[model samples]
Target chain A: MKQDVVIRTVCRLIVPFIQIFALYVIIHGASGTGGGFQGGVIFASAIILIGIAFGLPDALQRISEKTNTLLSCTGLYIYAGIGILCIIFGGNFLGYSFIPLPLDSAATRGLMAEIVEIGIGITVMAVMTSIFYDIAVKEDM
Target chain B: MIWEFNFALFLFLILCAIAAITVRNLLSAVVILSVYSLIMAVLWAEMNAVDVSFTEAAVGAGITTLLFIATLSRTTRRSED
Candidate 1:
């Protein structure tokens, strides 16, 4: 059997740490300036690393192009819904202060920020994965 | 002025970009692009954007290089000279 045939133990060590670090950036964006886009890219990077060390065909087995496409569309919908809910409540779009959630106080702003970050993460990760798939399959689109 | 740093990064970006374009060697081009990213990352950090630097390192250094190699392998090694 080939040494690289099995999933490398090094990947198990590295991937989790990268993911947790990405989350740290996403949640702590208020003062630090890192946000959903950056965190999402990093998260996608981790998955991509696995894709590289393993193989494209195997990676696709887990992430599939269809799933990536679905996530890409769903992320935008989530972001748009936040704005729609704000407007429905008689507030300006993205006026996150008006979001009617269980949370109260300035925490609401944090809540809105975090949600938007998550949306960004979803879109970036999904889109990036699709980009990899596209290039891998060599489908001109 | 921020222009100073911008100019430095721009210079590296341009030179590497030209190398990637003009040279027939695909691998060298990819390597030069990695250097370009490193320079750009440094510029971002100088501008007090640690987050952008982090992202640039991950995307530019890690993923972009990987993509290039993978794509390059799918094609031929030698380019039309």
Candidate 2:
């Protein structure tokens, strides 16, 4: 695919802003309307925009299959690990207050929720990008 | 909720939905579907469902349209029936 200067330039200019907004959505999810899933989808859309403007090879180089797989796994681990940590602390699964934190119970729960949101954001971003790559790439036999 | 705005949006929504299904060109269909999604997002927001509106804007209009376009590129552009 021939790269157009207009599309490429616009994509480069906007990708950063898109990613930042996605992070904002994820971080503000506890108190606001957006959440991890929405943020992750937005982030993935940025990568997809890059792919559309710069070609699949360039996008893949930026985020290779191996890295994508690793990220998805790591996000899931973070989510489950926190849940198990709460269990070990004699609280129900994902009971954020049970974790031995220096902060008050409400603060601890809030912090844990934030971490969970981050985990979810990471997983969704990686998985969505992976899905796009799988669908977009042509199989050369 | 403004009834006039809601009525106009619903009219456009129906038109887009019909156009999306009836259009023979797959690309046009995808685009119309994206437009439909955009209008739906506005309606969701008008109804005070901001979260759903955001999701519709992002996933429905943005990612889903791109995916459909990608799929169209991989297949034929015109529909047989």
Candidate 2 lDDT by residue in tens digits, A33-65: 999999999999999999889889989999998
Question: In terms of docking quality, how is candidate 1 classified?
Answer: medium
lDDT of 2 by residue, B1-81 (tens): 789989999999999999988889889999999999999999999989999999999999999999989888899999988
Candidate number 2, chain A TM-score: 0.96
Model 1 chain A: ten consecutive residues of lowest lDDT: A1-10
Best by lDDT: 2
Model 2, stretches more than 4 Å misplaced? A139-141
lDDT (0-100) at residue A4 of candidate 1?
Answer: 76
Query: What shift in Å separates residue B45 of candidate 1 from its native position after superposition?
Result: 0.8
Question: Top DockQ: which candidate number?
Answer: 2
**True contact recovery of candidate 1:** 0.55
**Candidate 1 lDDT for residue A54:** 64
Please, what are the lDDT tens digits per residue for candidate 1 over residues A1-141? 112744556775798999898888778766576777877787888877677666666677878888998998988988888878889888898788887778885788778777877888889888877777776663321
TM-score each candidate.
Answer: 0.82, 0.97
